[model samples]
Target chain A: MPGPGEFELIREYFTSRFQTGSRSGTADNGVELGIGDDCALLLPPAGKRLATSVDTLVADVHFPAGGDPYRIASRALRVNLSDLAAMNAEPLWFTLALTLPHSDPAWLEPFARGLAETAHEFGITLVGGDTTKGPLSITIQVTGACARPLRRDGASAGDIIYVSNQLGAAAAALPVVLGEVTVSPRQQQQAETAYYAPEPQFAVARAVEGYASAALDISDGLLADLGHICDASQLGAELNLDQLPVAVLAHSLQADAAVETALTGGDDYQLCFTVPARHRDAVQALQLPITPIGHLSEEPGIRCQWHGKPWQPRGTGYQHF
Target chain B: MPGPGEFELIREYFTSRFQTGSRSGTADNGVELGIGDDCALLLPPAGKRLATSVDTLVADVHFPAGGDPYRIASRALRVNLSDLAAMNAEPLWFTLALTLPHSDPAWLEPFARGLAETAHEFGITLVGGDTTKGPLSITIQVTGACARPLRRDGASAGDIIYVSNQLGAAAAALPVVLGEVTVSPRQQQQAETAYYAPEPQFAVARAVEGYASAALDISDGLLADLGHICDASQLGAELNLDQLPVAVLAHSLQADAAVETALTGGDDYQLCFTVPARHRDAVQALQLPITPIGHLSEEPGIRCQWHGKPWQPRGTGYQHF
Candidate 1:
């Protein structure tokens, strides 16, 4: 009658749904205990290592404060899933710590639905979570199983860099997401899809698992994330701007502007990985959607080349502070 | 020069400390990869189930917004560790999703040290985390290893209930913590320690592992949390108020007030467990710091008895929303 209290809200929206859902046979899925417990008990696959990552999306900082609850949920989970993919892991179980401003059923309904659908899609189960009252934010911790886990420090000087699919659509979609730009209905839909549902590169990760020596998901733009691989491996990289696979939405902008967006746009959720020369043929034989965009070098800093000439972007990447 | 960007801040405060510290041999400890990666890779103990839980503590709602960062970090991690103890799990690894209003080194320094010390104290490792910009909040997800887990659904009607250590100190310390009341230096220190450094009942959990039927950490309150065990096990409980191990700080209040606080005040982080009559002698023989508070009954609701007379407290526990 009073829209339920904290426990009731969790029960009605998350616990009941997850318990009765198709994936409720938790023991069969390595979950010995799940929701409605102090802690969820899980059994990681026998010989495989567990790959775990955590990410937090705060209202206004990560997304619009009053954005669509469904989309927000989708983005938050997917963004975290990307990290597992980067590690070349298979999706397993996840925990969500959701802090909300109030117990609004309107917000809870769609958010729960979105999370359930996404979890089902990714073959991940919502094992356990804590829901509290505070400023809206979602902290998702995902654990997966990996046999041949990809890491960011295995790259060598002769390794080539590649990225899955395209980039910059999510960054370009910001204008539309924030209502700063008016666009055609089709463009709006595309922008929303790109922004809310950027696919994690699980398939690419699997395709390049044995071949890729270093990898990470691009959440802080290509240059920034590539810098991570370089820093970890003690190497640098040289990007081939002509080989960049810019998203169509970003292509709508001026030529250089599109390249800048492709170079420095965060939230792409694309995999950026490195493969040694010996594994190049093997990786290419898989016919994956990934494109070779750069090459790790012994140099200590990132360099850019446009059509064989030296180049530099206007800025680096998104800054949290 | 610029107070370090996000990456540099993380490296300077967290990564460098954790890497060069005594726990750097991650592989020997089952952490294949720790911080500075897409994900933390871990190998769960050979035949043990993994118990995991997540908790989000917000500024103002959970604690004072501008409180000492060191104690805040300690409380956040210890609170999550309590869940592991409740499940009879040994602390393993944890991830922190910290949302800060800004990247202030002064705040980060103490917080990281506090977290590192707590991790060392609990024999846990800091696996991975995401630091972002937002209203100050800390979301901690802890994973532990367990052979025989204690679950709330295992209790039977005839099981005797017990609580570890003491209760009501944390709740009573709130006034002192918030500066609403003043006391002697020793009292103030005791209040702060009770409020901030709640010892997760891992020892108690281990002692009762084979004998206890069910258990959980007393977070919301003795009455409310025991209600959880009741709802899960489909049984009720009659709390013997006279038997409660009222905390020393709480004893400063009136007799009834101390009992009431011990009954309904929360944040004690003590374990409440049930054991069948058959295991009573074995448990008592262990001589653990536990007191028999009540017993499970065939009834459907929680009942309280104060010196053989029914009693009701003014409030149940802390309400989140």
Candidate 2:
């Protein structure tokens, strides 16, 4: 008998039947050549700079092994799409390099399904990639187009900082996944949904396009990620403790614990961005769920304030070492 | 104390010191934004389709775990560069999604050195990607430019099939690497060199440009790779068994073993391209060790012949199960 081959596996699980995003809407059929070739060809929209990024997810490191393969697949694709969102780029296409120990259709069917669903939802077309024999790992590369690319170093000292949504739900879900804590089924489902299918803030990114100066998706907790923006923009941030959008499920923890999680909870795929003081009223008038959590300043390091007084902190969540 | 953190590690080892492949030479400075950004930006040359390919290399699957980190890094970058060569595209920039058990400078310095060396040699710049904790694997995504991109589906009946160099040296080197065989010091070095670093046929690809109808680099063995071309082009191939360019190390094996190894052995990293009858003279005139081992035909599958007698093959090559 023939080997359980690469092409056969791709054809069985990763082809047109598994296509997620609808190509008819906004995506131009930019795929000149796709799978079954030496390399895939893509036509970048005329006169637009191409924005490309890559992210890899490994079992037991990024997620628990033996977890829901469908959700795992979705997290991998969406996080990379989050990078496209961070750049304020219109989503174009993606390629996935998947390495697995075995070609079990049981795992692949739902995995491919989730991948397709996320792709279609994000309007991302699958271009090409390679699958090979190895430990369970996925590396997703996404490319998009942008004219006025928002960068992380463009924030001025007087800019106001904002985050798109509430924080810490995914980080709060980890204890439930590890069975260290119990939650009501509804809360568990909510946390798991946040953990598995991260909203990449693509719509929020578009809404803030020219108005936002420096931006990044909050992946490494609010503190560490804002520290990143501070490092890039050569400025610091001052956060008002009372203004943070704390998630409902995290509120179940001790008061201090809940506030800590909200402040430093990683895996919140919300946009953290800055707008100059001159544009504050204009940005606030947009009337989106944009929260004014902090302000960029000429200070040297993060200064957290509680009830208008200096508040000391412990650690930011999920520092990848 | 701070964690042996991701951003710190990147700043210490993977910064400008690791920039390889001079943009001043043949490589145009296509990088509009690079390593520090959310997504690196590139201005693709006008009227050119962007050719993108991704390849992942895993330790103990693609290479031994404890081998030299530098050589392993070089191999990972080069094999992906081979894909760009196959498509006959000019190198632009690449993003690397690298996973590691931990960040150790001893391993990373040499690894970054090797990565930079190969990047400079290929004239490709490092763009944006993520580093996370996981089993060690490297996924490289390369994008290049080509006006008339070479593909596998354009071969015609009566087209001549050519390969860039001798085959099976890397596959032949496997046993030596695994301690299954012994050879002279010189022979061991020769085999190891081929195994650790397979040369991509970039110059040969340039020579055959606009003349070759369909092209691919032989990562899988000659028979298997040619079969891929035939499958894509909806044609068959007739190869002269005696005409196979078996490398000296592989040639040293027994008659049947040598033939089987030459036919089925993989990791050759040689170019297999098809040229129309009309452009045969133009292609051959370039004269860079061009070898006519076969011809595309109207049949449906690959047919190997020796001295006008049909040869029954053992198997095509390594099939990734």
Candidate 3:
């Protein structure tokens, strides 16, 4: 009961927090005409269709309790945006369901600021949401639009697989949770930044819109996500571990640690996509830091080559069950 | 951890739960291809735009902790579907976010069955969702489609207000939580059924589409829901309690109790709409057993008369904060 009432909390933390993007006309403003009404009305662009995705993050399961609300809001919203990015969609509106143990304005202010900053960055507006008192959890359902979305089933055999940015920031940030390694003042800044605030690959997603075959953002790690593409396209893949865009493990604790982090660690909000081999040059010409990690194959099982030896997944990657 | 892992539990309970209504197409369809994917994909019909709404039900906050999961699923999903119905949209797909203290197959089986039944009845496909280990909560986000959705702002001052079904089954069912009233085998069956299984006014919504000025389904109490319409239209209302569709409450409880429940109980899942005064007969001919509870006024405040005297909300109907 210490928290703001659901209506006031939504008004203070969500409704009054962000500005609508330029694309949303003044009539269809950031605060849609229908927010406080029964259901919010969204006007998608004329030629485009709507794309939607929902994700829920629970305390202890998704984030540590007592973590900064600012970071939690950032991470929670960003992950959903990453999903939109996977489909090469432009985020238009989002609905949040925030459940908290108690309402605390002190905590809410920073949280709202974080959410607003991210919403502004993504050009998305917070349209409407439900707030309730309960254990700490955030469920975000984002609606985006795509002229032609890059889907998992769109990949064909022999398409080259590419990944944006480096992997394992979130996995490496896990040490901050366990207290196994004390983050230095600067590293704490770096690790916490990466742990809490994942940069959604929207720019890269937009850049690859017309070029990529099948695309999805990396949340459950590279191998697991590639497995999704395989299952969807009914194809196999051969990953070159040597070509994986991960930081050098030797620079940190153990040599193989980075591999484990890149393989099974979750919460890396990077883009994993497959493009036909013919478009490799066109994709590369975008001058983005993308690494070809694998290739889709005619066969039907995931295989990897590490240190010139065949490699199989040692454990299933990031099982929520 | 005693509950089944997220994957196995989802596979066992949710993967094959609902039949995909869109299976005539080539897309790999099983209730929208859920569970083994990064994000669920739902394909709506070509001409329809998706209308989405989200609602969260918390333990002790929304429903009691040890309550039946079947009812939880039914009520949770129905409330969300009710939002879509309010928009005069046809139900299409829904995503669920289930947070539980433990994974109990006993709880999930009935819950999934309830969700499947509702989805089948409404022609909605269960697209995707997250299952996390945490405090008990259920967050459902449902999407439907419509060519033209009814807006609250469309209501004019002279419109006659109407509501389908009677109100207060959820309120009458509250005694089961307080243990004040002993529930008989039959009463228990009815009360529990009412508490959990709310029949969304989908047929009524489709029948009254284009006939109603502005519409919404009552999940909050009658006064509270009508308040939304009033707030949106910038108008007031005068309710003649004598003409209210109070049969459901009248048949179930004592006179005063029925009146109280009819006014203040939540979770009716019935449509509350407005129709222009001139078109009232045409609206009435839809013959959905609707009652002319009130009339929208040029003035700007809500007023109700009970037994020829003024009546106001005795207490806050239901507060999530």
Cα RMSD (angstroms) for every candidate in the order listed: 2.1, 3.1, 3.6
Q: Which candidate tops DockQ?
A: 1
lDDT of 1 by residue, A1-321 (tens): 355788998899999867622223346459878898899989888999899999999998899888899999999999999999999999999998999988999989999999999999999999899999998999999999999889888899989999989989889888888888898899889888988998999999998888888999999999999999999889999899999999989987334599899999999999999999998888988999999998999999899999899999998898887
Q: Which residue runs does candidate 2 get wrong by more than 4 Å?
A: A1-3, A18-27, A253-256, B1-3, B19-28, B253-256
Sort every candidate by DockQ, greatest first. Answer: 1, 2, 3
| Per-residue accuracy of model 3 over B72-114 as CA lDDT, tens digit each | 7887888888888888877767788888878888989999998
What tens digits encode model 3's per-residue C-alpha lDDT throughout A167-286?
A: 877788777654668856776676777778787787887888888888888888787888888877899999898888774321253345778687777888888999999999998999
Better of 2 and 3 by DockQ: 2
The collision pairs in model 2 are: A20-A120, A21-A120, B21-B120
Q: Which predicted model would earn the best lDDT?
A: 1
Question: Each candidate's DockQ score against the native complex?
Answer: 0.86, 0.75, 0.48
By TM-score rank, best first, the candidates go 1, 2, 3
Score every model by TM-score. Answer: 0.97, 0.95, 0.89
User: Scoring only the second chain, what is candidate 2's TM-score?
Assistant: 0.93
Instruction: Judge candidate 3 against the unseen true structure and give its global Cα lDDT, from 0 to 1.
Output: 0.76
